[model samples]
Target: MDAVVKKIIMEVKKGDQQAFAELVDLYKDKVYQISYRMLGNVHEAQDVSQEAFLRAYTNLDSYDMNRKFSTWLFRIATNLSIDRIRKKKPDFHLDDPVGGTEDLNYYSQIAADEELPEDKVVQYEMQEWIQNEISELPPKYRSAIILKYLEDLSLKEIGEILNLPVATVKTRIHRGREALRKRLRHS
Candidate 1:
């Protein structure tokens, strides 16, 4: 962490609410994105993201300065998301047939510029299918896969973020990929 961030953390620890709020501002979107990918629910993602920040603020004393703050924050978010997933009955299954979807306007220009309409639709479908399969992974495996692939974190970094052995993280990612492959083959 930079000196300015270290100063912010210190200020928060000293009961400066604004400093804590600033920290939340910096990390909230990332936390929410991780939660959304892990849990596959918008409302729960919002809740988990808010709770993660709260926990981080409350548990500031336990934070080890020797570690990267981003890793620590992500750890908390992922744990919260995992716990949430474990507690809920899953709302959807990968085996279920998907319905048609709305176009993502952001992809519109790029897809139009680069490919024909049919190609864009197929591309979008494939992307959505992959996401669905990933969402169906076991919570532990799902978090590991998302951290490794979607967020593009190194295996070692993922292990650190999740407080798992490097070997364990590797295994989870491998299993998650195999699961996705099997699902795609069936589809």
Candidate 2:
């Protein structure tokens, strides 16, 4: 952890409400994105995000200062998302897939690189299709894939976040990739 975050954590530990709120503000987007991607629902994501923060605050004293607080927060968020998935077994609602799939904006850049406009459109569609496929993966695999590829975390970091071994994380990523490839291939 950086000095500023450490100072904030110390203040939070001392019962500084402002410090806690600052912590939430700093990590809210990342927490929301992880939950949204993991649960594939906006409402659930918001609930999970809020719950994760509450849990973090409640257990802040037990948090090891030696660890990265962001990872710990993500661990809480991902666990809540996984629990929601298990308890709800939410049906694959094609009509209400995960929100925020619209961040993909590569059409112009690719168009300038000799890729025709038609091809760019197809690419965008394929990307959205792939995102949907990812959201459909089993929770473990989905978390691994998202943390690794989307969030750009390393295998060790992903393993820490998911409480899985590195080799297992690798296998999950491989399986997730193959599953996505198979889905696209069939489509």
Instruction: Identify the candidate with maximal TM-score.
Output: 2
Query: Model 1: per-residue lDDT, tens digit, 64-164?
Result: 87777888999999999988887887475434444454543433323344545898789978877666777889888899989988778898989999899
What tens-digit string does per-residue lDDT give for candidate 2 at 1-187? 3778889999999888878988998899989989888876678889999999999999998899999998899999899989998898646554443456654443322346554599877997776676678787888889998898878888998999999899999999999988778777866
Backbone atom clashes (below 3 Å) for every candidate: 0, 0
Q: Lowest summed-lDDT stretch of 10 residues in model 1?
A: 103-112
Runs in model 1 deviating more than 4 A are 90-128, 185-187
Worst 10-residue stretch by lDDT in candidate 2? 102-111
Error of 1 at 99 (Å): 20
Candidate 1 global lDDT? 0.83
Clashing pairs in 2: none
lDDT of 1 at 146: 90
For model 2, the superposed segments whose C-alpha errors exceed 4 Å read 89-128
lDDT scores of the candidates, listed in order: 0.83, 0.85
TM-score of 2: 0.79
Name the top lDDT candidate. 2
